[model samples]
Target: MSVIEDALAALDLETKVKLLSGQDFWTLPAIPEIGLRSLVMSDGPIGLRGIGWRPDDPSIALPSPTALAATWDPELARTAGRALGQEARRKGVHVLLAPTVNLHRSPLGGRHFECYSEDPLLTGEIGAAYMAGVQDQGVGTTVKHFVANDSETDRFTVDVRVGERALRELYLAPFERIVGAGAWGVMAAYNGVNGSTMTEHADLQIGVLKREWGFDGVIVSDWTAARTTAPAANGGLDVVMPASGDPWGQALVAAVRSGEVPEEVIDDKVRRVLRLAARVGILDGAEPAVAESARPSTLDGAAVARKAATRSFVLARNEGGLLPLDPARLRTVAVSGALAADARVQGGGSALVQPAHVISPLDGLTAALAGEQTMAVGARPPRTRRWSTPPPSATPSAPTRAAGCRSPKVHSGPTSPVCSARPAGASSSVRRCPARTSAGWASRHPACHRPTSPSSRSPRVSRPPWAARTSWRSSASATSR
Candidate 1:
């Protein structure tokens, strides 16, 4: 038996049971007596959010999975994944909750940006490459939303009714590749698959993932996903995240004492978690990782983000071959739209990360053409629909700028190009715009208006203005011609 197995054999029933659930939100309780360290995890597919979950603690913001999928290059995906692993290491994170391989079943799916293509083949290939890269860096990667967690609508309770053929062909295909690639962990979805919640699905979690496919890694439940005790433990769930009160705790202990849950089940769960700890080099006798110094060195994250962003661009519908604009021939090209100066690097929700720097479409154009272009902040993306992650608490983190203010100022006279707007869907002062500095009010519009800073307690002002506006449409039109 391995060290983790040996340690598991010595643990009492209660200690083993405690190991099954998280000690608190975002961390597992460290079993100091056994020399097991608390393993830290962070939310991400595009990038790592780490524990602070604040904009001030910025992380590398790479292209979204959908953007990476558009590149149709597995090597590029692997490179991006390696960069993610490096970021996790810098942030002292043991596992990254990423490479969300769920398919794009519906356009209206709240998290389409977090996933790859709708096609299973593409999702599988890209996901497998990403998994390989992350594991290569000695940090564990969790391939998530196991089995039909495609949408966010009533995600906790909605039942996904899919046939076996469809499940294998579509929903499970990407996860299959990730498992086959030997991913260190898998996260069960909040929703139910067929009639049983995924956290308690014995056939898939145990019979298929562990028994048939040989996924020996830990299986962690999505936060609060485990709603019951005996079933989840018996179904092969190894960890309950966020350490809060959950389906597995005193209740699980009672079930085991009553013979509803076998001792072997508890042992198996503890063993798997211990296995994960060993793999990440956190178990006893393993050399502890060197803590990153204050201001850890960023291993060329900017270069990786740039390469991924540049390669992921697909020239769809270049009609009339109006090919790349020749800077030599163009005297003055007028670029319109606010997003031209402030690009939307990624989509909304938990996948969001505050990038160190974002090079806007206009930024690239201006640098290339030099004196050959004029930018006009004409139309913006539609604002009718809002894409936001639900706040975790009564108050959310203060907003930060996703892209710098690229809004050009034409102060020919008092009739300057200006319009007054407030924070989208706000009742008060988050409405006031700040001075013309980077990460200010211009995130939404290019108006030359200045107001006092909003209260710090307000939610983060991070909704990328380009998210709602047709910024890309305008950029493509201007550049191609």
Candidate 2:
């Protein structure tokens, strides 16, 4: 096959054609279980997150973000970009879910590493360079967190409550610049702006992102992000990420059919997604299929992964002249903590990833120490002392687990039905992340269950008829009924 044809063959059949063909192609029942349209999607932004067939713990990589920024080397960022993009390509991924450029508002913010910087110039410059490299090889780049996704604290339902000036100058500036730079995709952040959910906010998604910026790209709702169909579409969200479940697609389809949302809005999204397929070479068949076999490690995403990992690793304390560890005679490296064993590469909530393989620092060190004997220890949560199995990996040792953020009540698992909410007449959502669920929102106020495929467009509420539910009246609303 010619390079284009070779690339084309790599793409799933769904992504290998235009709207008519692509839609039919995507909607076809090639797979018996679900909508395994010939083509499936992989994530983007920082990297491709691989999820296991049966769901696993959230695999979060250490902060490689600020590490790349510290270098201030556009080329290195580009290299990281290329490597990540290549990883997506090898995995048959049509869209890469990354290069999250939300302007860092505070250092304490958990996702600081995943995003670029606080300054628009630095963030935009590096982001633009990164996207160019990623897209050049046919894979698409999705610059994200839309506006103000900097902090993880109360992320889902909290509104940033920013003014027009703050929103325009800082939060949305980098996105605008990157859009101008030919970024093919943009992701809506979970945070709300001006008392509106980013996913369902029309003014920002359409007025600002599409019309003012003239971004002719696909706008995918961040995982499980869509709260309502009408505003979400009118606001310009195209392909909803992780497609099926949630307050997204199915709810959207229902809204359209019920006359709650206009048909044109639906077509607009379809066209954009289809157009994206063509641009990314998915339509031409250059895209790889989303299968285990697709991620063939030629140069081994290892070499590249290592470099990316290194860049992402912040040399926080060179205090005792540590690190750039001298394998020759470093004597013994004492490792501790839960992170030491399981290196969390991504975050919880949406952007969760499942890499093909994870080489924790402990894993790397053990291999390095194989020749030379080393002391080991394995205590619960580990001591600041030793390790028995070369230790897993090491986070800042300052408590990897967030002290406050509730381990959120989400409903996902084989036996668990996907849960969500919908408008009165709308179909229940396929999947709804509990983080986005409001305290006293709806009739069911139920977490969404994956709606029946030929996915239900009929709205369903969670409350069983007999349950007398009471509201946890908050300070936000001071009403007594």
Can you tell me which runs of candidate 1 are displaced by over 4 Å? 286-299, 331-336, 372-481
Taking the tens digit of each residue's C-alpha lDDT, what string does model 2 give over 257-320? 6787776666566556545655665443334322334432333445655665566555556867
TM, every model: 0.76, 0.61
Residue by residue across 236-279, what tens digits does model 1's lDDT show?
78898655446678888999999999988888888888888887
lDDT of 2 at 343: 54
The most accurate candidate by TM-score is: 1
